[model samples]
Target chain A: MIKVRKLVKRFGLKTVLRGMDFSVESGEFVALIGPNGAGKTTFLRILASLARPSMGLVSVAGYQLPRQAADVRRRLGVVSHQPLLYVDLTAAENMTFYGRMYNLPNLNDRIDEVIELVGLTNRRNDLVRTYSRGMQQRLAIGRAVLHNPDVILFDEPYTGLDQDASAMLDEVLRTVAARGRTVVMTSHDLARTEDLATRFDVLSRGKIAASATHKDFGSGNLLSFYKGVLEEGRQN
Target chain B: MKKIIEDRSPLSLRERAEGEGKTPSGNYLRAIGAVAWKDLAAELRSKELLSAMLVFALLVIFIFNFALELDVKTRDSVTSGVLWVTFVFAGTLGLNRSMAIEKDRGCLDGLLLAPVDRSAIYFGKAISNLAFMLIVEIIVLPVYSLLYNTNLFQPGLLLIILLGSIGYTAVGTLLSAMSVQTRTRDVMLPILLFPIILPVVIAAIRASGAYLQNMPFDQILPWLNLLIVYDVIFIAVAFMVFDYVVEE
Candidate 1:
């Protein structure tokens, strides 16, 4: 679970997240949609213990962040826009490397399972540098869940992926949710998000402007809703 | 006094942790080992970092040979200093390249996501940088000896090189992690590292010069103490501040 109360993140004169409040319960698949510079990544980074909020209380999987971040990291898995894969390392090597870092048991077997899950088994021995963007994105997905974390955060994972790759990512997230892992993914792709997300929250101008369940979302009207939110945000 | 104690009690959690107390569940030794091993394995596969550092170090030594016009007398006197200077410069090269690889390729983010101690990443990189410096030193010592027919196999000199490399790499690793994040990147490493690590360079050179001169242990002891003091202080400082440097 992730809980954030009145979070405010600013860099000098610029405010990124302004007194925002949000939470994601266990096994929930929530899509965090926002425009560029709307602070979705900032919020996820804060929860990931990779960034400190300028002001707020944040607890991830019950460990308070910026204070008990190390404990929280044990339960948290993050996949950002960046693949975070070492280019020179083989897919197997990267997973083994991270497994050692997490001190995970049965390292080789875990690496195999995760690589297989990402559908990179055929190219597991090849350097990640040679992988396509889609392959790298899938590898990033594999790496994040390798530790079987309680909370997983993805920021703009759909960037630079083909349709098939996107579909593969959607299937992967569905499988992950079935295994009962909480996922908070941010994206601008409303259609893809609509397919994978059970719930959606609109972030505009550093605040949660609107939230709705997937059932409340009409597949035909979701794009119109997203456009309306953007128009309203721009007008303000 | 009572008011101050009340104000300080809660903040003591930070103070205690900073004082090297319990850090969640991870062992410092395991954390350090995991980090160092990852770096070493990665480098062994890529061979980019070590190769760049080795070639750069050799080039620096070669330039010094021509620039200083080292006759027989000056070569013996200046060899240790020259070798260390080369190591220091080349060490910076390797440190910058290593951290930059992590930053550019996003490996740093993956490492940060791991449940291990953040200091493990710091020490891991530091130890790997130290290893590279030592390996280069070992290779250079023989090359220098062969070039000038001077004996560099002295145990005392080897010890100085070890201490000096540790001090240099500890601070260099920390500063490189910071510098790589900035826009200036590789160019910024030496600018940030050299000034802060001046004490290490000074002590390393002096102690090395002393050993080469066959000076007594008493004469060389102060410089060694300086190295130890520097190693302790910066290692602590680097460990404490690593979280800030790596934060997104």
Candidate 2:
């Protein structure tokens, strides 16, 4: 569903993604794990067509990067550290606005479905500014999936959620995965992602140093595996 | 020969519909309308931006009253300049704050992700910004007329106002998108905007001044033409380049 070859992203004198090659098949839930400044979010932004790569051959759902960006955008959804929502608009209004942008058919029905899926049915009419951070994040999720995108990218979506909100988000993510869509999520919370993601990739120094499926670590410890990979990267 | 071939090319209705979702042009127009409606609706609910612009405009007029000492004869020469100056300053305030709100709220990124043509976003924002400025101008005109006892309601003056605003906002919207992304955004907008928009303001003041002073058609025609030319040139330039300005 997604492909990247020798992906290199540079900002002025600094380089963030360095010669990275990655691919994901349809319905694969990938947990892109990395420390700060390790280029996880940068990679996701490139996939979402929000940033152009300095050099790479990248494609999402068969559309080329930067050239077919509008086509790619129509097939993908993105949730960054910021919710990317208007705070003053109500939840339903936000969904309706995005609905129009995607030119969806029967938009009112889709808005209702996504709002209920996020469990914001009762609060849908309230202004987003009046909601808590968790509620806003939920609405962001609903907005992302409103048009039924083929791929969804989540960048640290649980950054500022409480315990209950985190649990709620987990259920929502599980539901999304069950629908068999391509999902790439970047997170610092390894424990939760370990249970959710089918594959785990450790990004270090702008490259994927280690990657393993859940079955590869069967009866083994993911924390120790991650630590060993980082230590190995440090030595090399 | 090329024109004949182009005209002879087949345009199957079903293929066009499939290529660009159902009713492509209609959907494009709807997207533009949706964006404008969202901005206007948010402004209506908050009233923060409009109120600030209105109060600042009235305050500027009051200061001008004290600073210029507009006794009957002097008022005739200076009222158009004062009103145009007031609109320019107040219009910048509105433009800067409007773009800043979108940036701070992450709405700009949200809009960028939309599948529609980027120019639709530009037109939507320009239209909304123009609406806000017009609302302020509409209210301020009568108030200024009453205070200075100058008939500011001339039909030609109104046309000039509309034309000048189109030129101001066409450029202002593009510049505001650039300025809001900079480090010193608050100070950046006026600095970037005023220099570029000087032609629009000058033509507007001159044409408006001529209209108010009951000048001959020959005297008024050039400034009016200048305003139209400025509006057309900038609107076309801004529309063509807006995609690059909003790129991350």
Per-residue lDDT tens digits for candidate 1, residues A4-80, read 89999998899999999998888899999888889898888888888888998999878898889878887777887
The window of 10 residues in a row where model 2 chain B has the poorest summed lDDT is B1-10
Instruction: Give TM-scores for every candidate, taking all chains together and pairing residue i with residue i.
Output: 0.92, 0.94
On lDDT, the leading prediction is 2
In candidate 1, stretches whose alpha carbon ends up further than 4 angstroms from where it belongs are A215-217, B1-27
User: Best-fitting candidate, measured by TM-score?
Assistant: 2
Which CAPRI quality tier does the interface of model 2 achieve?
acceptable
Encode model 2's per-residue lDDT on B1-248: one tens digit a residue: 11110111254211232356567678789889989988898898888889988999999998887777667877887888999999999999999999999899878888988888888899899999999999999999998988888888888889999999999999999999999999899899999999999988998998888887788989989998998999999989987999889885
lDDT at B104 for candidate 2?
A: 92
| DockQ, prediction 2 | 0.29
Give per-residue CA lDDT, model 1, range B117-158, as digits (tens): 788889888988898888888888888777667888998888
Query: Candidate 2: lDDT of B12?
Result: 23
